[model samples]
Target: MKTKYWTIVVLALLTAMMSVAPASAKPVTVKGKVTAKEDGSVIIGCSVLIKGTRNGTLTDTDGKYAISANTGDTLVFSYIGCITQEKTVKSAKLNVVLQESPEALKESMVTGYTVGESVEDVSSEEIRIMYVPVRQELPSEEYNEIVENGFMKVKDTPLSTFSIDVDAAAYGNMRRYLNKGQLPPADAVRTEELINYFSYDYAKPTGDAPVKITTEVGACPWNPVHRLVRIGLKAREIPTENLPVSNLVFLIDVSGSMYGAERLDLVKSSLKLLVNNLRDKDRVAIVVYSGAAGERLPSTSGSDKQKIKDAIDELEAGGSTAGGAGIELAYKIARKNFVPGGNNRIILCTDGDFNVGISSGKALEKLIEKERETGVFLTVLGYGMGNYKDGKMQVLAEKGNGNHAYIDNLQEANRVLVNEFGATMHTVAKDVKLQVEFNPAQVQAYRLIGYESRLLQDEDFNNDAKDAGEMGAGHTVTAFYEVIPAGVESDYAGKVDELKYQKPEKTVPVSLSKELLTVKLRYKQPDGDSSKRIEITLADDKANKVSVDFHFASAVAMFGQLLRDSDYKGTATYDKIISLAKTGLGKDAKGYKREFIRLVEIAKGLDKE
Candidate 1:
């Protein structure tokens, strides 16, 4: 009877355990490789996630990932610039070849010049007019820096500091991807640049400083729990006649990679337009690099436009790249003809492939940083795609106290070189840095929208030796920060335990009780070493005012956040972004704002697919 009772107890316990367990409780390790279906090439850094769970992992450089899941559990594979896919785990090995999503492939063949069909299929005259080829295009291998800004507690981290970035390359590159019917890589959608690309109407400064500061705060468009803060820095506009004489060196990359008309031919045409805009008081030199660097045209007065045009037209693409040698030689030429108080600059045009020597971006940065002390600026004009090295170009421009632009077509070229000539070539402020201190009493946490690569250590803000971005005349730089109001719970918010050894002080202060945040800016005059400081305080007011520019910039910020799939993009969607952008389509003389609205609409349609 005792043995029978014991057997019954064991049987009952087993029955309960079996009934409670999941139907497919046993888990097996699933392994897979994610490759491009078309080329069978392994995709690096693709995301692999278990369905209905937070468990996920990224593919290694070899595009392989292993995750533990039960039979019938779904697995998802996703990557930027590619379509997302899902599979149920039936067996242990579930390799996947991700086909380019219809959305990514849909608009890719639409080369902005023509609406439909390949350039080769078009009439000969039409093909000649567009200057595009019939050859199949390859995916862009361009690299961009990635930086994610996380929410910071005002008490633990009071100060937010970063270098000011005026480069608008990201904006144009994004346009290229959109036109091709594909979403850009997450790294390619920089919020700050997208916001700063368009001009904003801000009050000019009446003081000694070359830049005026503007600030506005309002309820965030995407997140009701958060508020938006806009900081605008506008450089004083200078008349073209009063601008300094320019000493320009045109550095052209003639490597075989540039043989395509979209590369070398387009560059030549763009340079001609710039040559035509040159003043007789200015000087121009031409340098070409292809396996070796050499002078294409000796320093010639800008008055000799024909000579410059001739040299530009004669450029041919062949041989390997010697970009480092070309850069050094161009700088040497510019220095030899350097004029005091003049706009001395080297304008480097390339796809940014530097193969021969000193090719690494870090080494190139050190070289450019060392050369910039000579008071010469650099202008990086990126041309072509697929092989464009945007990261290297950004580093060179930032370190050399200059600017960067991406030229996709003649229209874009004109926009950068002609429409904004003074702003592109003239530098009014150097090493500009911004630091914001938020009041913990009113704010729970804050995250900068963009400029991840431009983030600087708090101590670096006041350091004169550290390099920052340069501001050009009439150029406006804008940045956005999202703030979570006090009492709001956010995933991005941090929790800290009470200190054992120290006493907790009051959250509010008498002096700064009513203040929202203090914005501090430090910058050096175009040629000065020491820095000048500017401070402005924002009040914590219930009534918030929003401007068209502010709304428009906010829309752009949302667009970037969505592209990057940021965790902080609360309640953001393409339709909402489109609506916000539509509100600001007023007085868009250049149609840039309208263009943004159209892009948003396109993205909306694509997202649905």
Candidate 2:
């Protein structure tokens, strides 16, 4: 009887305890922000994952993230260049600050061009350029050439001169910042690059000329009273079978700064894709640099794809960046294996962190300029970020007569190296310049939408000695100009006092008055010394008939202006941009246009925030 009573009492006590016990700790929605400990700046794209679970999410542009977790469950936060942290979930809100990884700090010292186990053993000369952030201060080392293209009066400045720019690094880099829920800096928003990033349906070159010029004039979307003129250069597209034999030098950066998986590892993967596109007639050489420069592979036949890929796979990151030395070595190798009447180029992959010998921008430019005289083209592929030297890379690409592309992910790599192989590697024209003569009778003042760094003096257009931009096979370059008609009034366009010393010019002929502008393009053959000129006359009647491409291009230009907060933007609102972009989203075969719409929406939200 006593035992039965005790068992009943124990069962009753256990049931009471079980009834009061929490039910598996009901899932609670946890929200938090991840920021850099150094500066308290929100870290966009920081990874936040539930510990021991597959559920994870990235921080938005504002460094905010949300996850569902149970009491006592842990959450892990990780970011590149920062230490990973784990926190126990006790409340619905938990914020985190990630510190710079100690391991990364210790690995800053470079012993040689090879990966070292310890930084303490590294010598002074072996040290490469690395981001050494001070405690409580994470300095941004990003570079951008400021863009300041002001308004030009037609009577004072009749000729608009600029180099043709096809480099799309700024667009990709801008996408990076936006996708991470942040707005790109003003300097990073290169208006010309953003305009040229997409393909426009323009007529192909049908004549012996390597490129054809296409011009469009349409009502400006931002200010209907004003007008926008677009000049497009379309290079002839050559079939892959007709491409000449290519001699390529892969100049890779393997410095300590490139230690992350996104840096060296992604580069190896990217190169492997390019290797697959090679032919037996193609020859490739591998050059890697850190504290020093070394040749990893000799000029080997592209038929040996496995060998080339293996060499790339074996690459390890460490040491200091010797970008100048590496460029010299790569060019030397390219010259040694120089193929006449064939494609000869050096593809430099780096973060633009040139620390060692000959690291100055001027020195690098001079080196590349001299080597370009040997008929070797340069292709600069920028990788990694957070201390990326965009200005240096731009100079290298400009002076070396090469294209600049920033590869943020594998998809971009595939686009640049594989999908657009011919356009990316094959040159159609070089030293290309555009000069537009606006009719003073039809226009009062004008402002170029972009291409600040590419602007040239009027004399440079006819000067064969002046260096301009290179056009690749099948590449398209576009430029936008905002014009104020003679009758329209704009606060941005300041009127200049009439020149008392010089008499007022006579009125243009009625026939010429009807013409909006004449676009003159000067370009040289890939291996030619002299430039060939092409003139395109745009009429007022033609300006009234615009295509989807014109509207789309105008939308992109307006977006850039809004992003840069340009004084000439007039009334470019995000909603207005979205509506305008939607109407012209023709074909959008690659969905890049649609993607751009989404980006605008994201920007809209971020702007509100």
Over 4 Å off, model 2: 1-138, 498-512, 542-544
lDDT of each: 0.80, 0.80
Model 2: per-residue Cα lDDT over 347-454, one tens digit each: 999889899999998888889889999999999998776777888998899998889998865557767887688888999899999999988878888888788889
Lowest summed-lDDT stretch of 10 residues in model 1? 121-130
**Tens-place lDDT digits, model 1, residues 1-609:** 999999999999999999988777568988888888888877654667777775666554356778777888888776544677899988899899987653542223232121111111111010000112222344656677686898888877889999999899888878776666678788777778888888888778768998888998999988876889999999978887788999999999999988765688768867776777788999999999989999999889989988888888788999999998999999999999999999999999998999998788888988898899899899999888778888888888988899888876555666777778888999999999999999887888899989898999999999999999998889899998899887888777867778999987756644637688999999999989999999998776856678888888888999989988888888899888988888877687655686677677777777777
Q: How well does each candidate superpose onto the true structure, as a TM-score?
A: 0.78, 0.78
What lDDT is reached at residue 86 by model 1?
Answer: 91
